[model samples]
Target: MPAAGSGLYVGLMSGTSLDGIDAVLVDFSSGTPRLAASHHVPFADPVRAEALALCAPGADEIDRAARLSNALAQLYAEAVAATLARAGVPAAEVEAIGCHGQTVRHRPDAGYSVQLVNAALLAELAGVRVVADFRSRDLAAGGQGAPLVPAFHAAVFRDAREHRVVVNLGGIANVTDLPPLGTVRGFDTGPANILLDAWAARHLGEPFDRAGRWAASGSADEPLLCEMLADPYFAARPPKSTGRERFDLAWLERHGVATRRPQDVQATLAELTARTVAEAIARECPGAAAVCVCGGGARNDDLMARLARLAAPVKVTSTAALGVDPEWVEAMAFAWLARQALLGRPGNLPEATGARGPRVLGAIYPA
Candidate 1:
């Protein structure tokens, strides 16, 4: 048998933000996760548009989805090849790849969360083993089947004597509270960058507001912010998760965001993100020693400032301080999950995902 923590795995993640692909070549041989090599592949404008279209009802969705899956697989294979080449590691020398495909539809309450990618196609193209469909087993066992990274967070960022929190500011933000005792807890905090991106795209013609500059240029509309905070999703109890289904453009139009001045709406949207995330941390992990954020949103200086201000005195910083860059944590988590599957170990946290118990996640395809 191959030695544990003596192998390399590549992790692929394209989050709900529909931004791009993040592929990381992670080495576990050192007994601690290290980024050997990494590369990001942005989706073409047309590809990103189609991905957004699939989030809602659209024409030729079935055929488009099937085509998109294959296209994504091809892109995924290229990414794998690029990362391995960058690391100077051949495909045969690598172990397996853990892939978190693009999440267009996540409906845990309905007992299904779809992450679109073809593992067989990827395996065939990359000529390496693949592990995917990580959410299904936990969903089958009666769980939220999300915020899956807490287990990985606990493994890497947890302190034996001190409490810590890891907040992922993805399309939708989620937080993992690692206390010194008891079970680890995590859940979706609500919209983070998705709305910010959507609003930015509409008014600024950009995929996202760079560093949230546009929002920082305008003041948040207080009434609208209050109305948005009143959303039941915010006050809902834990063991929860959400995605494009709950907070998409339709959700925004219904909230009368269109009628408001565009810049103010953008400001309110950014404020909405910061407030929901900060309040969640304050409420869920009051005594957390520090809140380390990781994700695309972490790079937004204005959003980070808001998070720091709202979660003040509790300490807020990026995962960089913890020896990991903010943007790659999710991808790295999937790499660790892939390792767990290959080792026949459990990857989901029961308390975090509301699973029946610890269960080995993901399906594996041999090379």
Candidate 2:
């Protein structure tokens, strides 16, 4: 049997944001894995459009999703090649590729989550083993099958002397609470960039508000912000996971967002994310001494400032301060998950996912 954590691995992640694919080459020979190289490939306009459409129910869904999966597999393969080349490594040298396929629908309540990818095709194209469909096994084991990175977070970011919270601000925000001693837990805190990105694309014709500049230009509507916080998902307890299907543009419209000025609405959305995350820390991770944020949202100066103010007394900073680039943390996480799965080690944290117990995640597709 191959030794655990002894080789290079590639991780691919295309989050709910639909921003694009992030691929990373990580060397795991040492206790602290080194990020060898990373590459990002933005989704072409049509692909992004199709993917956004598929997030909701639509006509001829099966056929559309299947074709899109193939296209995404090709993209994943290309990303692997790019990242490996950047690291000056060969495909034969890597053990496997861990791919978190694009999430079109995640309804853990109904006991299913759909992440689109063609793992076999990816393995063949990349000439490396592929481990994917990571959530289903946890779901089968009666877990929410999400916030899977808490295990990885515990392995890497946990500090023994002080409690810390690691938040991944992707399309959706999730928090992992690492107490100095106790069961580590995590859950979705609510919308992060999912709504912000959609709102920006709709009004600004831009992919997202750079550094949340447009939002910073306006003020948050207090009433609107309060109403957004009333979302039931915000009140739901841990072991929960959510996605674009629950917090999309339609959600904004139903909450009377149309009447507000676009920039003010943007500001309100930013507040919603910041407040929810801060509140979650207060409620679930009390006494957290520090918070390290990783994901695209870390770059949003406006959002980061709001988070700092709201999560006061608890120092807030990006994961880069802790040695991992914020943009590539999630990609690196899946790489760690692949290593766990290949070694038959449990990847899902029982406390994090509310699973009956720890479970090995993903299906392996040999090269």
Instruction: Point to the candidate with the largest lDDT.
Output: 2
- lDDT tens digits, residues 98-213, model 1? 99987768989899988889889999999988999999999999999998999999989998887889999989999999998877999999999999999898899999999989
Give the distance in Å from residue 234's predicted Cα in candidate 2 to where it truly belongs: 0.6
In candidate 1, position 104 carries an lDDT of: 68
Cα-based TM-score, every candidate? 0.97, 0.98
Ten consecutive residues with minimal summed lDDT in candidate 1?
1-10
Tens-digit lDDT track of model 2 for 1-367: 2234347989999998999999999898887988999999999999999998998999999999999999999999999999999988888889889999989888777888999998999998998999999999888888888989999889989988979999999999999999999889999899999999999999999999999999999899999888888888898888788888789898999999888899999999999999999999999998899999999999999999999999998999999988889999999999999999988999999888888998989999988
For model 2, state the Cα shift of residue 355 in Å. 1.0
Residue 251, model 1: lDDT of 80
Quote model 1's TM-score.
0.97
**lDDT, candidate 2, residue 94?**
91
